[model samples]
Target: MAVAAVGRGASCNAAARDLGCATSTVVSAVRRYREAGRGALRDRREGNGQRKVDERFRERLTRVLQRTPEDWGWCRPTWTRELLCLELERRGLPQVSVATMGRALTSLGARRKAARPIVQCPWPAWKRRRRLYELKCLHAHKPPEEPVLHVDEVDIHLNPKVGHDWCLPGQRRVVVTPGNNQKRFLAGALNVRTGKLTWVEGKSKASDLFIQLLWHLAGEYRRARRIHLVLDNAAVHTSQKTRKALAQLGGRIVLHFLPPYCPQGNRIERVWLDLHANVTRNHRCRTMDQLMVRVHAYLAARNAQRSASPCLRRADLRRTA
Candidate 1:
């Protein structure tokens, strides 16, 4: 507006007043426009001192982030802005200030986050990869008569699951606990194709909990010749009692165990996570029964939304004594 006002023969002081800026600002803009004909309006900092965080520097920073500080002979395990600056300088790059390094990391979409603990799979790399490939092929190319399900178990407690929640600044949200924690367990199976879920609850996450889920699946998928259950290798799953239950089923259900500690392969793990996030996390239910009711309601709604077929009948979700 200032530039246009000046172009329309208005004085610098009038243009500055109309644009709510100082007269000197209007004068400088007009001088640049006259000298370079609009190109001068572009950012003047383009050629400012050789770019500190150029493409090559960003690539090196990314590589450095992938490794630990120990790899660079630093005593610390994690990287800080000052440490990052020092590391970059050690790599023969131009020394940048801590603030500059912080801005560079922000530009690279880096964030300071708590590191998650994970267990490494004990199987050899080749064996693990081959098994995962086999499972993938089975899931993709399974016969129509055979149904594949990713199975897993989760625990529910009367004591609310503590997780991140939104609250006003300087205020924290509180979830009252039951004082005495009461727990229940759920074993669920997620359909690979239809995304339907079949689950059963029990007092404990024992072999019977898994067996109850197996029976529930058997009843639901009666038409399927073989119900292939992809599950983690939990001890209860491979227990003698579980084996006996499978034997009684007469090969109608087949258990395909995933490599140890590989929960990512089991799709049902995501369902349990959603269950916790939506129903169990920060819940205020005072009794296990109340909590279970809400859990059941959430699962039923989820199944209704995901399954084109009819939802599971109420009796099917009965808790095992």
Candidate 2:
């Protein structure tokens, strides 16, 4: 409303503040409006030239981004603007400059980011699908008297997990780590029906730690006839010692192993990820005790948050399930 604001005798600075834009922008807009009526308010670039990045180019770029630079016979593993232009040329598409390629990528909402590592299950597709279906059915149709939990373990360290953070233009955030890192391990179970979490920490990520978590789960869910845990095939979870602990617990706790190499199948994995993101990443806690304190505090806060809201708990249960 630069024209309206100027019509009311507001200064360019005042109009700019009202519009949340630069003063010069308001001045230019008012000048244009005065000179050329309302038509000048429309985009002036409409008839400048033929568009360089059209839907066809954007669609091609989208397909290219889904694959890697290596797929197009490039030695490099990652895509760069220059390499993208070259690949487009090789594919018999109209060649563009590096800058044009960047603009096109921006338009397509593509970004340069670190690749996440994933492990594919080695099982045959049918076998994997069958096992996943079984797990889904187990989660959906398990007896109400038996509680199902997604179980996983996480390592906590005196050394902070480094991650990105906001900082001044030329400044970087630093996290100090104890040179000789001390470690703590947490075994956690996330309830499938509710969003409740039960966790126990130990000095080592061993069979003892897994058993301790089992004991905690057994106690926490004492009312249930059996506690069904969906866990990965970690050595600690399948060890002789762990089996003995389970036997001693008298089948009160049953284990359901997920398809091999599929951490995504375990809902508790997301809890561990949130643990890292919220408490452990770039943490300034100097000692193992301090870090553990922070970790426990974060988990406790999370549990409390989950327990306080019924609607949120239901939504979380659905999302994780």
Clashing pairs in 1: none
TM-score of each: 0.80, 0.80
lDDT (0 to 1) per candidate: 0.88, 0.85
Clashing pairs in 2: none
lDDT of 1 by residue, 1-321 (tens): 678998899999999998899999999988998899888787788877898899999999999999889988999999899999999888989999988998999999999989989999989999999999999999999997899999998999888889999889999999898899899998889889988888898998888899888888889999989999999989988999989999998899999989998888888888888888887899998888878887887787788777322244445445411
lDDT of each residue in 33-147, candidate 2, tens digit only: 8899999899888896778688988888888889998987889988889989988888778878888898898888887788889988999999988988899999999888998
lDDT of 2 at 305: 74
User: Judged by lDDT against the true structure, how good is candidate 2?
Assistant: 0.85
Off by over 4 Å in 2: 1-49, 307-321
Which window of 10 residues has the lowest lDDT sum in candidate 1? 307-316
Residue 36, model 1, lDDT: 90
